[model samples]
Target: MSGPHAPAQREHGPLPFALPRVTATQRRRAAALLAALEAHYPDAHCELEYRNPHELLVATILSAQATDVGVNKATPALFAAFPTPADYAASSPEQIEAYIRSIGLFRNKARAIHAAMKDIAEKFGGRVPRTMDELLTLRGVARKTANVVLGNAFGINVGFVVDTHVERLAKRFGLAPADATVAMTERWLMALFPRDRWCDVSHMLIWHGRRACKARLPACADHPVCRGFGSTCELRISARASDTDRTKSNQKPGSASRAAKRR
Candidate 1:
């Protein structure tokens, strides 16, 4: 966290990128959270597997409301079949659905992939657009998807990614106000961190969320980051324990539900 890739230093004054509502205190707190994430999950990165920009774009589109694992499981064959944007543009959406039927919202994802690929082939000369505005013109590529592509595929960092995990962690850690919308959350995060570290910030926070600060229950009572954030998580922890106990009592030992948490 203290080398060429370190967050920009501006501790003596207001952060230049911060929005009007952001205070210097919040910026400092945000820096601590960023450090905690780095300390805990230093190798955090985009989980979606891809060999090229188009592949990443499709994988991201398929990832909507779907798990990265699920998308990864389906992508090998899909990528093999349609190796390029032109391949997808040449085929019909129905054909695309055949490869991704296992993914959630396969039909809609198929349409998005088809339309987006068509756009890339016809509009962008078979290359995924690099800028946010350009990427948004393609179907299924909203802000989150654009951030993922811009940060991971092209090594650009224009905004913070505000996915479910980022949103949950942002609120729990008080990075953004509790009532912040997705766009507002992104803005708060962008304001708090430097432009250069924005990509790293999103990856680290997402990794922390998936590994510890989960939506249903977190696994970090003793973890330093949770403690540093002034976590009020004991109530939820106790509630989960009680629910787990009830579930165990209700179900027989070694049942299928035994491994499931009280989600």
Candidate 2:
């Protein structure tokens, strides 16, 4: 048994499967893939609902520990009650907290939103800043939220966003190595896809993660992009089987088996 152990490998260069340095051919493939995904999800956009940057900032804050659906439920009343940055700047934390009580960590989000609004109103003339540096100045506005607003709202693609779904799919798609951090993942994705497609890529990848490449179980059997990635497809196929078992348990006894046969 002691003979079964082997020496660890070492390297100062790329990971064994680090997405081959983006060649012109690879870029072309990426472009075609992007085109297909864009066509498939033409309507894909930021899930957070907001009429303006200020609302987007607030909604993104609310979305920290809550789903976009839940945040959407909370924002209509919040946006109506405080229609302007100045309104949020002047409002008490108690007022903002009341509107967003349904979201987790409302108290902290209330504090961040109130402070950020005051800063925006006083320093930026009651508007959310379009540039990365200025946007980063707002409380709770990190690269993820800033990228979201700048890309979707202002059409400025400073960099790619690395959200939970993006992170998961990035790994599952073999776009980045297993140990990739958010910043590293962003760099990897930006390198692979074209600059203009960065924002849309996040949306498409997120949609895929939600509908197919889920965290717990990915539906690789039906995912068109599975094989292009690599061994992750194997992981997804297994996860898909696990999903089938759970699904079968919830359905009429023979229904799932029948469906499998038909497929």
Candidate 3:
């Protein structure tokens, strides 16, 4: 009934559900979860190291499908090689690729960075755009990247930044419904948490997910957050178990249910 580990919020919506309304109980749980996370990880902040907005933007772009650790490893030389938007714009994508070859999708990312930087240099006076709409116009700059840049580079909190960790933890914490899409999850997170705390909310949830509430083999046994917040662990475990059982059942040599036969 109370604490960070509260009952999962039951969802109710129309036949073809869009974003379901946040319940009063879920709101309470969200507040509690934020408090607990803050207490546990007082120093939670963005892991992507950058000295400037352009650097942060570049790091964020490179971070797609790659870990922050990986991006950080490859960014120093890249940042030094092309210190500004104009620098990146003047350089070819092949040149950019040379510096960031260690990252995943480096070729595509190099092209994206080149295009985005060219737009920034030519249109925006070599400065990173502060607004969401302007940021979205640049290549590789979606809502998530825009949110990260705006929130971190500037002090703007237009929306919550939903990454893979935030997406998974949002459901497991019941801050958002299990069936909620990423967009809907962002909407729900914005509704539950305070507007000003949106940036901090992103960092805390991400840190928590990385440290304890990992995707595979979570530290639900003895981790302080897991110990204190144990209610949703069962739900997540059950969900994963169900998925595993279904996969195994499908792969089994000879197992056919009436549902499979009927289909």
The lDDT values for all models are 0.82, 0.78, 0.83
TM-score against native, each model:
0.82, 0.79, 0.81
> What stretches of model 3 exceed 4 Å from their correct place?
1-21, 230-233, 236-263
Off by over 4 Å in 1: 1-20, 232-263
The digit string of per-residue lDDT tens for model 3 on 199-248 reads 88898899988988888888766677666656376566778999988888
lDDT of 2 by residue, 1-263 (tens): 01012112111223223433677866776677677677667766777878777887888888886899999899899999999999999998888999999999999999999999999999999989978888899998898988877776666777787899889877866678889998888888888886666887888888877777677656766666654554375675678999988876789978878998999
Q: Give the least accurate 10-residue stretch of model 1, judged by summed lDDT.
A: 1-10
Return the lDDT, model 2, position 142. Answer: 93
Sliding window of 10 residues with minimal summed lDDT for model 2: 1-10
lDDT of 1 by residue, 220-243 (tens): 686778877865464567789999
